[model samples]
Target: MATDDKTTSHPADPARPGSGDKPGSRAKRAMLGAWFGFFVDLFDIYLPTVALAPAIAYFIAPDLGATGIAITGGMIFTATLIGRPIGAAIFGRFADTVGRKRATIVAMNGAGIATLLMALLPGYHQLGVASVLLFVALRLVGGIFLGGEYTAANPLAMEAAPRHKRGLYSGIINTGFPLAYAAVSLITLLLLLVMPAQGVDSAYAQWGWRIPFVIGAVLAFVLVAYYRRSVDESELFTKQKGTKTPIKTLFSGRNLSAFLQVFALMTGFWLSLQPVAAVLPTLLGADGIGMSSQATTLLLVVAYLLLAAVDVAAAVLSQRIGRRTFLVYAGAVMATVATTVYFLLVRFGPGNPRLAVVCTVLVVIVVVCPWAVLPAYINERFPTSVRASGYGLAYSLAVIVPSFYAFYQAGLGFVMPFNYTGIVLLGVGALTIVGAALAGPETKDIDFRAHADVSA
Candidate 1:
């Protein structure tokens, strides 16, 4: 499964729009548009994680115990995740065959519509169980577009980026995740002050929850407009449009191994990220750690701000050393340091808000830092023709088994405390990342237009 693409390669095509040959206004605008699209992609994805988590009872009975709520909520979250691979396949083909800019616009518009419909959805009281079903369906649909967003945008930004600056560009592009998290946190925090997600009849449970979804919808539409106006298609992609089905080519012969390796690496990332991104906020809230809603969001905002900085630093460092080497060491730290902090997090649950903040910060940083290298590493692994398709599929395909993390937590609950299960998940994820990173070639120096510099 190892990649060994070590040949002299041509530079970016000088004639194409947003070419790295002369990094100027066009590349800058394309990069910004791609980054903004990704920012909003995560904005919608995290709305369910941060914005709707507290108010999920608005769709289900509040009388359901914590475990029951977790099951139902995970089901909702998993629905979205399940749709990602499907979206990756569908939109990956579209982006590879047609164009990144167009695929991205369609995805943004579709995601916006899905999010808008979610805000308009009636609660449990209005339609009984049917309301939850409809919510899950919409989320599934939303996840498809969300999957396509990064599939197209990341490659667009990377292709537009000068090879030397790819590492920095990758890190800058990824800041969208934590920044979006912070944005969602800030918005949700303000709403909690007025909405108050306490009971089925509470203001937040009724309407305040809808505000974030509405805002998320607006963000998606705004990105659509931005992309249509400012973004440019990948010159590399335009130069070599895949005549063969990109998806089929990925699973054929040697490309299959590359796909599997990417799948493995991304699976680890998704596993490690799930707890920090989705569950941690809830754990810090009144139920698990006894903090007020406002305090929890505040702590998350601080942690995410810190994470954004670390992400950039780590990505830049990866360029200096190598992506493979960085990931191996980072995965090691995640196994020991990150998991140990998680142990501290769960052990010291309830009271001690300051210590809780520290634990959460450490865990968040340790678990997510390796992610800084992935956009560049994965993009470097595949050639221009299949870059988006391979990226989309490899990225989203891995989330399948790991998306059942809540169920795994439930099963693990028999032998240990429910909260302690996160430690195990983190440890396992670390192993996968380390093992997969070891299999890949160093990719920082690969030219975007050089097929000989990448594995099939």
Candidate 2:
């Protein structure tokens, strides 16, 4: 069950090297390709966050109330999260029927084209109401394809990884997300340094945001080529590709428990993480932390780097111990350490850069690092026949709930005293996940090639 005992003998693995070849190198390449595909998908997803401020100023009419801008901003984010499920339904089916490689190629290209189109869209000044419509449409398109990328790439990577080291590979793949987030932040920080911040009217603020989208579009296309040329289809997938409906297959009685387990796990995972990931840096300044803009940016960069490192370490440790044990302990940490850190950061962040950094690091370690092994864990839950569809559906739906974390926090902020809303929500989310994890079976030693019955 441990790393040394599991077979590395997937002779039929499409990416497997021939006699006298370095098998490890080929597998590593495949993993890196999957990781990069995820990286680009996340980069495109986070673009809206970086663009939101400039977008609000440029795209909204001044006469409209704050509610109008808030609604618009919320819609922009909601549109993408909604579109992902739709994409998951479609591409998940496509991946099982056609091939993971083909589905990935199509999805990546679709996302890249949609992203490039965003760069060409007119702002409110040029297109008026049409601009908002176009923006939403483009975001929907990007979200759909990005969702497809997740469904396809994750299983491909998990199946490609050496069975014993799936956790390690999952950790590497998870790093793609935070790395892209950090990259976007770095890009935005640099742009803001030079761009004027003259509220709502600064030309650079309005147009400069487009530059990153353009770069993302280009990166997407490059990934399309790279994935097509470099990545291989999962041998497990190839062996089990079926002619039946994957979605329906997932809901059959035999697979229902696995589906529900993943759904709960994904829900708790995303709901707990998004608030901290999206709000922590903003909270630093809002809490009256005396950190300068330069200091804030540096802190965020360091935090993300630390997050990446923790992800790897946590993933490896999960393999050594057990997935269930690690998850249970991780849930405990999120419930206890992360919540306490958030409270301390909010209460004591004023004039304390060192304290702020320390608190942020603690939150990252507990709340974020444990998620690194999720791809592998989810993949382990189902057989190859419905793995992509099940993972995609569960992940997409789970993400939809968390997408509204902003609204949840806003509501909590209104009712809660002393701005402890975030800490409380984080605890609730972590406990929800912990409850779900307690119901799940330990899957660390599950054989990738073995499958459960598809029918009741």
Candidate 3:
């Protein structure tokens, strides 16, 4: 499971004979394509939040009130979480069996079609309870595609990246989320300004909310075309083919330990990160903590911008410091300080936008840094043959359960009650730190090809 200390040398030109450059060159481009697809996927997934108010108004009866709509929307989000694991199972196996290129294509295209259909569907008044059912069904389908996208894309990027630069490359790929968030935020702002709002009734019933979904569908299609023309099968997969490493066998041989390790790591990561990352803004916004919608949007955009930069930097830093040490130290610091940071926000958040901004900045600095290095670290743990499936299954299982909890908490109007949520996050963070300290292997300067069984 350990990569050899000796480095493989090649000619200057990767395209020339005896040069190991072609695969490296191809991997770089493929990584870009994979991340581009990921960017679009993130955009589509988050766009719904911007339209949540309108969606509820259109679907729920006036007598039912906002609480009812909140509950319904929460259900949809939970349903979407359920679909993620299904997507991971189906697409993860396909990526291992068929190929990463084909699997990615299917995921991107399927998500696009699902979103487009959602854009066209009628509202509650027009379709009744059937409308809500249709929305949930479509979200489920979209979730499946989304589930497959990350599993295939992350492994593809990692396998393609140069060994020395894998951490940085992985970080760059993950930066797509923040970039997509910024883009979606900008788009939502533009739509809010331009769209004629004749109150919640007309906005939701007519066309306001559909605009973003339509735009996202178009973006998805565009990404599909881009990936189709630019991306190719990973060299690592080709090199490791015919090794008798089917999906089932992955859990049996040397890969078994690696799989468990990744599963445990991801579980802790998701449990600590998802709720804080995804739920905090909505929680703060709805709580009337003096952060108006415009101010909150501005703060999110700024935080994401910082997150994108820090994430990439952390990835590059891992090359010098080593992945294990970086994750362990960083995870511990974030976990230990997160509760204190939340307390700071709750204390100073009532009338002070400046203090709120500071708290926001602190949260991003802690949460996003460790997340940046994970894709590369996980990728280095498995062989190219079963990498996609392994990473997908592990990451999805970790994400789905925690994400469900996040939606449930939001639905129940839970927040920093006696610092309960913060305590939970801190515990998970401590677990991540402990896991890394105990089990994480140093991947610095290791040859990815030689370490095919590192997770073993």
Candidate 4:
């Protein structure tokens, strides 16, 4: 359907450029398919951030209070992140054993179903705590599927892309995550615009948030079809079809450091990136800023767009300077800018909306670049045999703590302004990432075509 040949392997290998049976077109299809699938997957992931507070408050309102709502929201996200590593371990194995295309289709379908179920879930008023439990359960399911997505899709894309252009392509494709967030922010903002301004919270909880989940669910299914029709198995993976025990291979002494380095990178990257991307909306709604939901959504939409642009630029530049150098510098810059902007937002954000928006745009630009180059960088670290599982497991495990950043910020809010809490978290995370990247090797010039039996 997409001029992709399922029966034969393509020329572009995930690890290195090679002369294969076909032209570079297969790689193009993989990149496009991976990009779209991730767009839908990440859109579903961040949509909850926009809806979580209002939706949970609707359930546990008077009895649970703000503290209760905050705890519940944090638990839901935590469950989602926790489930991801489990999914990655399982699905990454599948990606290695069966094929990337099979894993991708299964993961997408599971995520779509989980999201659709969330849309149909009864409120806390009707089912009481049972509603909350079911919601958490479904989110966990979604997390598993979403976790599997990165393992298969990112490797497929990277392996398909030309070695010389990996940095640029990696950045462009990974932009899906931020762009999806921007899309959700825009949709939420539009819904707020059309609805009556009065009783906004009540209206949003009642039905407004569900609109986005419904859209995400539909989008996921569409991507499933698109991928099924267009995506072919990775050429590099195809050559390694008979490799024994992918998970086992990953833990071999020679490959151990590669795993560890990626783990550190993923941990540092998510720790730094999640607070700004996921927690900023809640932070804005807190007492210090007290911005309305509509205003926050508008701010995030603009900020996410800026983040996407900055990520692309950073990704392309990584090609010239090398991934390690780019990440180290980016993380350091984000730390300085985020720490400074936290104060800026606190001093002027409440009284000056335009200034807050401008500062937010700048903050996102710095904080988001580290994530842009990770897919290609991580992909380059391992051979095709264990690439999916190694990358997925590291990526999923690294996010475990950051997933709870919202809850941590909420508690810290009592002792300090939430903005300061975010800044501290961002600063720490940026430094951690920079330190890890500094220790890790540059992946830009690595020969992916060679066996990844030894750590660089």
Q: State which candidate has the highest lDDT.
A: 1
Which pairs in model 4 have colliding backbones?
14-159, 15-448, 15-449
Q: lDDT score of model 3?
A: 0.73
**CA lDDT scores, all candidates in order:** 0.82, 0.78, 0.73, 0.77
Residue-level lDDT tens digits of model 3 in 267-334: 77777775466656764675746677777888888888998999889888987799888878777777
Each model's TM-score? 0.90, 0.92, 0.90, 0.88
Clash pairs detected, candidate 2? none
Ranking by lDDT: 1, 2, 4, 3
Tell me the number of clashing residue pairs for each predicted model: 0, 0, 4, 3
| Candidate 1, pairs of clashing residues | none
TM-score, prediction 1: 0.90
Compared with the true structure, what per-residue lDDT tens digits does model 4 show for residues 1-456? 112223434444434423232444666677777788779878887777765444556556456766777688777877787778988998899998888888988998999999999988878778888888888999999989988887888888887676667777788888898889888777877776665324325677777778899999998898789787876777778875624588888887756788888788777777777667666766677465778877777777777777787777888899889988998888888778777886798778887877778777777777876688888898888877888888889888888777667677789889996667877788888888888888788888665555455366
256-332 per-residue lDDT for model 2 (tens digits): 88888778888888888875776776776544566765576667777777889889889888888878888888988
* Regions of candidate 3 where Cα sits further than 4 Å from its true position: 1-7, 12-24, 196-200, 203-205, 242-245, 286-288, 404-420
Screening candidate 3 with a backbone cut-off below 3 angstroms (N, C-alpha, C), the clashing residue pairs are 1-453, 1-454, 14-21, 254-456
How far residue 65's Cα lies from its native spot in candidate 1, in Å, is 6.3
